[model samples]
Target: MLNVKSKLQTCLLYFYFLGGTLIIEFNNDEILFLEGETGVVGIIKVAYENKMLFIATQNNEEIVQFLEKDDLIAVSNFKKDKRAIRSQAYLTREENSPLVILNKEHPSTKRLETVLSVGDRVCLNCNITPGTHPEQDVLCSCDSLSGLEISKTETGIKLNQYFDKYTIEKF
Candidate 1:
């Protein structure tokens, strides 16, 4: 019994080591941390072929700022086309996360190009629950130079209408 338990522990430790370490704050200010573990909420799915970073935000029915595998981040305002693949936003990163669209001629393309860049967390039209914990609904990374993050909980948002921009403030 002792041998089996030791072996199990070793395997678990190995798996944990294989991942990475992350500190996440959940709802009610609940904090969780794991060493050598990555992707707790598993927001960004990186396939072997093409990898993309995705994250939804508070009151945002869809993804907020989606950084493509190539380092281009797309910003969307949840109006018109709500999905990150649709709405128009430039992150304001280099005048754009270059804007994600396979078809350059799409109507939203031009809007994305003209949209502004964000220096801080751009919380567009957020209706966070009164008691909602900051860490629960959202998946974010502070280490990122560009302040884009994802939300797991369903944040209330007005569909197809671009709201005013909020500044991404750094503490």
Candidate 2:
């Protein structure tokens, strides 16, 4: 049997167990570079060692490579449709790391709404008591903006206030 965790650590690849040869999917779920905030459809592919992802459009051919987990934004799997629901959320893991899901449109959002504030430091805790719901269990803390608005983007969590100036530390 292949060591799934070991392979993931080295390549940040996701194995979709397809019976024979493992089908490794490159997690290119987010498109970081777009013109004027327009959304772009990310290319998806299955790759193996020595074989990279390739695509051919009507007039262009492109070959792309994958990056390590640390070099990319964490992946997420939302259970609901974000477009229709307005606040759909899902959890996903990259490179065998702790799973993180967006925390929008959840009933628990009301619970966390009171705790978050502007300037207050927030940490995402994956392993809390009762691991029944990973999304609800994760925690965020901050010192200011007691009623901070929670939003989701291609990257990750988006606070209503500007977080560019503050240094965010994740555990």
TM-score of each: 0.17, 0.21
Residue 123 of model 2, lDDT score: 28
Can you write out model 1's per-residue Cα lDDT over 96-124, one digit (the tens) per residue?
Answer: 33322223234543343212122212222
Q: Which consecutive 10 residues in model 1 have the weakest lDDT in total? A: 39-48
Q: After superposition, how far is residue 47 of candidate 2 from its true place, in Å?
A: 16
- On the 0 to 100 scale, the lDDT of residue 61 in model 1 is 38
Best by lDDT: 2
Query: What is the clash count of model 2?
Result: 13
Query: Which regions of candidate 1 fall more than 4 Å away from where they truly are?
Result: 1-44, 49-75, 78-80, 83-110, 113-171
Highest-TM-score candidate: 2
For candidate 2, write residues 1-171 as lDDT tens digits: 433322223234333333332232233342211001111111111112232222222234332433222222211112211221111111112122232222345455443321111111122322332112232212332223223333332223334433222111111
Give the 10-residue window scoring lowest on summed lDDT in candidate 2: 33-42
Those runs of model 2 whose alpha carbons end farther than 4 Å from true positions after fitting are 1-93, 98-133, 136-138, 155-157, 162-164, 167-171
